[model samples]
Target: MRRRIHAFSAVLALLFVAVFWISTVVSELFLSAAAVAQVKLAIAYALLGFVPVMMLTGASGFALGGKGRHPLLLAKRRRMSFIVANGLFVLAPAAVFLSIRAQAGSFDSVFYSVQALELAAGAANLGLIGLNIRDGIRLGRRRI
Candidate 1:
């Protein structure tokens, strides 16, 4: 049951991050300023769901593997640590700031600068999450 919960939470969180990253990129590339603003606001609003999902993911993952010192679990936990930190410190703040800037029609250098940072950070999180998922699959396969 715990394993099921962890798997579901992890996948859900991954989907949330992927959608945020993809939407942001597509909006920036082809959409208008108003569209970008809408995307920004939408991402921010989505965080309401994303944040708790992440928390559940972490809690359930830790409950399942926190005591294990195996290399794969270690790797997953380390990646998760960075993932959580980046989500909290960098991504969330950038989303709010970008949302405000976009709403104000202030697509200045600072906004773009932060947007780039957000993209890079989001990409990093996506990769780390993918790696963790891969490691998790390996661990499960080993046990089976």
Candidate 2:
């Protein structure tokens, strides 16, 4: 059951990350005001889902770690920590700021810059999480 839950949470995390990345790309590529508004709304709604999914991901990851000293496990934990920190400290705030600017009908250069930074940070998170997932699968296979 725990293994199933862990797998489920990991999948959820990956799904949300992919959605966040694709949405950012779509919003950037097509800069119509209506498109921007719709994308911003989608992103805002995604955040509502992202937060809880990430929480579950973190909780299950820690539970699975189980105080082990395996190198892959340690690496996974470190990567997860970085991803979580990036999301909370950087990505979330940028998204909120962008959403507010969009809501207020402000689409200045600053907004674009923020969006770019958010996308870059998100890409980094995606890569790191992908590595962690690979490490997780290896750990599971080894039963360690």
Candidate 3:
């Protein structure tokens, strides 16, 4: 049951990040300012769901791994630390900031700059979480 929660939360969090990142990309390329603004607002609000699930992913993952020193577990834990930190420090604030700015139609240099950073950070988290998933699969095969 613990492992199921860990796996489910991890994958759900990954899906959320992927959607956020892709929506940013597609909106910027093709959507009007109003549409982009809506996307920003939506992403910001969406954090209510994303954040808890991500927190659950980290909590359950750590709980299941339980201070193991095995290299695979160590790697997953390391990636998870960065994932949680990046989500809290970088992504969440950026989402809110972008949403407010976009809401006001203030698509200035700062907004775009932050957007770029947010997108990059999102991509990095996506990859790190993906690697965590892969390592998890390997660990499962060993029944550890």
Candidate 4:
């Protein structure tokens, strides 16, 4: 049952990513510049917000117990993977879009700063999640 739930969650996450990427690509090809820019902004915002939501679901799953390893460990693994994947898959492209959207003008410096911040934030989250994975693996092994 826990595996099923986890699989379901993964499927949903993948679907969301797929839809966002496809929509963005199609919109970029067909939409007006202003519309594309708006879509990019929305995607950036949505990616930022998705991290905490997945974390919550993972934490709740652990608390409720599951069929995987120690529930806590399983949850940690899921959360870490989710964060790392999100940072890589969503945040990177979003940052690139933001930089491109900056228009390479007087505001270019500010745009670069914003893009740097976004990458930094994503990297920080990824780093923390990596640490959690290391610790979780250590603890999980101790139980074995």
Candidate 3 lDDT, 14-113, residue by residue in tens: 9999999999999999989999999999999999999899889888888887878889999988888898889989999999999999999999999999
lDDT of 2 by residue, 1-144 (tens): 777788888888888878877977877687777678677777777888889988988888888788999999999988988998999998888888888888788889999899889889989998998898889889999998
Best-matching candidate per lDDT: 3
Number of clashes in every candidate structure? Answer: 0, 0, 0, 0
- List clashing residue pairs in candidate 1: none
Q: What is the C-alpha lDDT of each candidate?
A: 0.92, 0.85, 0.93, 0.55
Instruction: Give a tens-digit lDDT track for model 4, residues 60-140.
Output: 446434455765566566666666566667565655567367333323556556555554555555455545545544654
Q: What is the TM-score of each candidate against the true structure?
A: 0.96, 0.94, 0.98, 0.45
Candidate 3: minimum summed lDDT over ten consecutive residues — where?
Answer: 60-69
Q: Which one wins by TM-score: 1 or 2?
A: 1
Model 1 TM-score (2 dp):
0.96
Scored by Cα lDDT, where does model 3 land? 0.93
Indicate whether candidate 2 or candidate 3 has the larger TM-score: 3
- How does residue 137 of candidate 1 score in lDDT? 84
Off by over 4 Å in 4: 56-144
Q: Best-fitting candidate, measured by TM-score?
A: 3
The TM-score, computed over Cα atoms with residue i paired to residue i, of candidate 2 is 0.94
Higher-scoring candidate on lDDT, 2 or 4: 2
Per-residue lDDT of candidate 1, residues 36-121 (tens digit): 99999999999999999999989988887758888999989999999999999999999999999999999999999999999999
Candidate 4, residue 103: Cα displacement in angstroms equals: 9.6
